[model samples]
Target: MSTRTETDSMGAIEVPSKAYWGAQTQRSKENFAIGHQPMPLAVVHALAHIKKAAARVNANLGELPTDIAQLIEQAADEVIAGELDQHFPLTVWQTGSGTQTNMNVNEVIAGRANEISGQTRGGKSPVHPNDHVNRAQSSNDCFPTAMHIAVLQAVTLHLTPAIKTLRDGIDQQAKRYEKLVKTGRTHMMDATPVTFGQELSAFVAQLDYAQTAIDNSLPAVCELAQGGTAVGTGLNSSPGFAEAIAKELAQLTELPLRSAPNKFAALAGHEPLVTLSGAIKTLAVTLMKLANDLRLLGSGPRAGLAEVHLPANEPGSSIMPGKVNPTQCEALSMLACQVIGNDTTISIAASQGHLQLNVFKPVIVHNLLESIELLADGCVNFQKQCIAGMTANEQQMAAHLENGLMLVTALNRHIGYDNAAKIAKKAYEDNQTLRQAALDLGLVTDEQFSQWVRPEDMLQPE
Candidate 1:
């Protein structure tokens, strides 16, 4: 490939001729060959938004030239539109402060701006990367600000809607099964009779609670640390720069973003992200339980619970001739596990902010974004592929309900607990029905037994 020399404070390096990144970006790309996981494009696009907002703010403050600022704004627009995606090639494992990725964005925007002004890409002549593109900011402030923007937008635009879609789908299924009674289980054993609708409603409630928790954590995430340049002192930044830039960003992204009240706390720690991750983790736990319950209820067509039938999306085993599997449930459960694990990583990373900055920004944002995307995509798939097509096995549920010894629970108030226990034990040990057992035990007459032991009557309170 053709190459061109680009210069930074360190020195000059040979960058690909077609690449828009400068020397620092090239150095980072070459220096950190750690892993294949590139910095999230969401973060890169967020950085572009920051740069665009910063340019407009800087020009309004008369700190930057208008022509130069306009060029930078246009370049930033391209980046935000994903037109310059290939230019940001830094890995997440580079600098702890995400300085490299920040500079990568700066270099790309500068190069593209220069090109727009009929200048070459390598040198920062018409639009210097640091002075023009990144005027009132440091990587410390810019990266965290970008992290917050990316996470907030993703959760609101993607995850929230996906959760609601799945929740609504499950709710429709619940209504359809409202009158379909089935045997309820506790401790993996039969307990009593319950309507299938009531059981599924529990999952709906869990998702509702989880979505509320996630929504509550967002106001804190909306607080941006943009003006806390370097050590949160706002050293080179002009007065009102923080608030002005926040206004610009809010206008650009259509979010309720505002400058953080305490720039020190915003830069030095990541409490908001930790709180959000905890909420997401709670959601993961809820999804895990829901998926597991569905898997168990839909376990077997012949030998297992078979109380509900999951959509047969794929074959269960490679060699099995006629086995269908709960693949969507398994997939959703696995995604939940991954999100739960990501929460642990985010928590530990959030705690490691030593002095005036949390150096673990990249990893924290990477994991958080990954969890959000996984959950959003997983919910959509589970809803469309599994929950949408799911059907209740009423015949199997009714048979199980009739065979359950726990139905004897209904006889307690009439015959007393001791008598009820005696009838249940006799029915199990002697292989007799509850009615026959009650007759032989002489607990109640046939007419009374019929009145006292109805499964449908046991569904609600007496």
Candidate 2:
């Protein structure tokens, strides 16, 4: 392949003639071959945003020529639009500070800027990668800034809306099933009575709590490390550079971007990400439990609870005819497990930071973005494939509620707990409904049993 030489502080190296990246990015490509997975597109987009904001801020501050800054900004716009995604080929296992990826963006933007100015791809004249494009910034700050912008944008633009959709879908279903009483279970045994709406409301409440936690965590994530340059002292960066860039980034990304209150702490640890990941982990647990409940409720139309009918999108067994699986619930539950695992990885990565910089940045951002994307997609899929189409087996629910000895819970106020337990045991021993057992044991007349043990009434406190 035809190649061109690009020079950095380390000296000259041959780069692919057609490639947009320079020496450092090419060196990183050759050195870090451990993980083939490319950095996530969200991070790349965020890096583009940061580069553009910095260029605009520098130009405004008279630190860079307006024409050169305009070219860099234009190229970064293209990168943000994903027109040049193929140029970033480095793996996620590179330098802990993500310097390679940062340099990769700088080189690509500079190369594209050079090309736009009628210069060659490897030319470093009017728009040198480090001196011009990466001016007043270090990989130390830019990388974490990119991570913050990416995570906040993802949560605000994708995860929040997806979760809201899920919550709304569940709320609509809850409203629809408000009167569908079923036997509620604890310890996998019948305990009391609850409406189908009440069960679904629990998931809605969980989603609300998760959303609140995520929203509360955003201010910290939006606190950027951009001004910290190499080691939190803002070395080489001009006075007010951090503030200007932060303001420009906020306007550009429309996020609540701010300079970190403590730059050293921001660069040395990713506590904000850790906190957000915890919230996401909680959401995953909620989703897993809800998915399992759906699967259990929809299990075995002929044998198991079968209190609800999941949409039959696929066959459950290869040999068994007319069997449909709860495929969406299965997929959602599996996704939840993966998200939970990713949270653990993020937590560990967050704890691995050294004195000045966190080396685990690539892994942390990658895992965090993966968790966000998985959860967003999972919520959408679960709503589309399962929740939106779920149908209550009203007849089965009524039957279960009528026969459940747990409905005696409502009678505790009238018959006393001891009598209620005795009635339940008597019903189980005789394989009879509690109503019949109460009648046989002279616990109550038919009218009293009907009034006291009504499942619909049992759904609420008397």
Candidate 3:
């Protein structure tokens, strides 16, 4: 190895001497450097924006001189504009205290701000990172504030649309299959006749509820923890800092951002995050139900329910000569499981908060953001490959309707249900078909039964 003095000849490094963080960042980078699961990128960007926005609000106040205030605001702006993104490299599995992430943000903002003011990176010469940039904040408040922003934006831009796409696909399929009559199965056996459209419409209705829950929960997330500096008391902040910061953030984010109703409550723990995780859990449950339907409808082409045909993305099996599977449904189901697991982790972490601060924020943010990302991705794929491409198998569905012994509802109109039930029981006992039993019983006139017993017409009460 020529070992060209290997002195970082490009000089492409910015060293941080005094970390803006208190202590947690150092220990975390050393402790959980195992997995590749990095912190959410949206979170990193949002944190920088929160810092810059806070600086702008502070600078606007009459307390600070105009020159210094403007300089601080400019530095914070540059970091939000993507200057400090690279320096925030760390895994999500750091200590639950979130000290590492807090420090990572502080160091990056301070270093970038110093560079903007023509000072050396990480220099405290005139503007110390903690003294000036992190003036009246702590990881306790800042992390939760950033987490709120990241989550709100994600639901508005990503999750909402993904869910709508899935819902619309189901609604569309429902319309397409509205006239298609199929035997409805319960307990793994045919029970009644229902239109394919009716089945899909139920799914659409469920997704609607899930979406509504998500939308309603997001506004609560807008309540931020800016002024709740250390332990949620606005202990070290200026008198008007919280309101001013809220105004600045609202202007920057175009959201109705506001201060937490109680600083003490905000700093005590991350209950808002817990609520958000619960919302995600609801969405995951909807996905699980939808996946269950997909698997059931696509159960088998020759030996199973096979009510609807799934879009064949790839060969479904290694051994079966001609097997195509509901892979997209499987993927969505798998992602739903992951989200469920992450929700459990979040719930556990949320409950683990000590007296003053919930040290579990880093893990909470990591798992929550991960769930959001996976759910968004899964919804998009399920819409395109599964719901959008699904086709109604009319012939098979009709055959199932004809084979089902549950079409006795049609005979109920002509003969009373008791007689129809007796006839049906006799048919099942004697291995005779319902149609044959009805003909043998002569309980239903041919003319009366023609309109009554038709599968398509039997979906509605006759």
Best by lDDT: 1
* Deviating ranges (above 4 Å) for candidate 1: none
lDDT of 3 by residue, 209-260 (tens): 8888777777778889888888888877888898888878888878788988
- Model 1 agreement with the true structure over 1-462: per-residue lDDT tens digits: 999999888988899999999999999999999999999999999999999999999999999999999999999999999998988888899888999999999999999999999988756989999999989899999999999999999999999999999999999999999999899999999999999999999999999999999999999999999999998988789999999999999999999999999998888899999999999988899889989999999998898999888998877888989889888889999999999999999999999998898899999999999999999998898899999999999999998988899999988888789999999999999998888999999989999988888878888888
Q: Which stretches of candidate 3 lie over 4 Å from their true place?
A: 1-28, 31-34, 63-68
Which prediction has more favorable lDDT, 1 or 2? 1
Question: What is the alpha-carbon lDDT for the whole of candidate 2?
Answer: 0.91
Which consecutive 10 residues in model 3 have the weakest lDDT in total? 1-10
- Report lDDT (Cα) of residue 205, candidate 3: 88
Top TM-score hit: 1
Better of 1 and 3 by lDDT: 1
What ordering of candidates by lDDT runs from best to worst? 1, 2, 3
Better model by TM-score, 1 or 3?
A: 1
Model 3, residue 426: distance off in Å is 3.1
How high a TM-score does candidate 2 get? 0.97
lDDT of each: 0.93, 0.91, 0.75
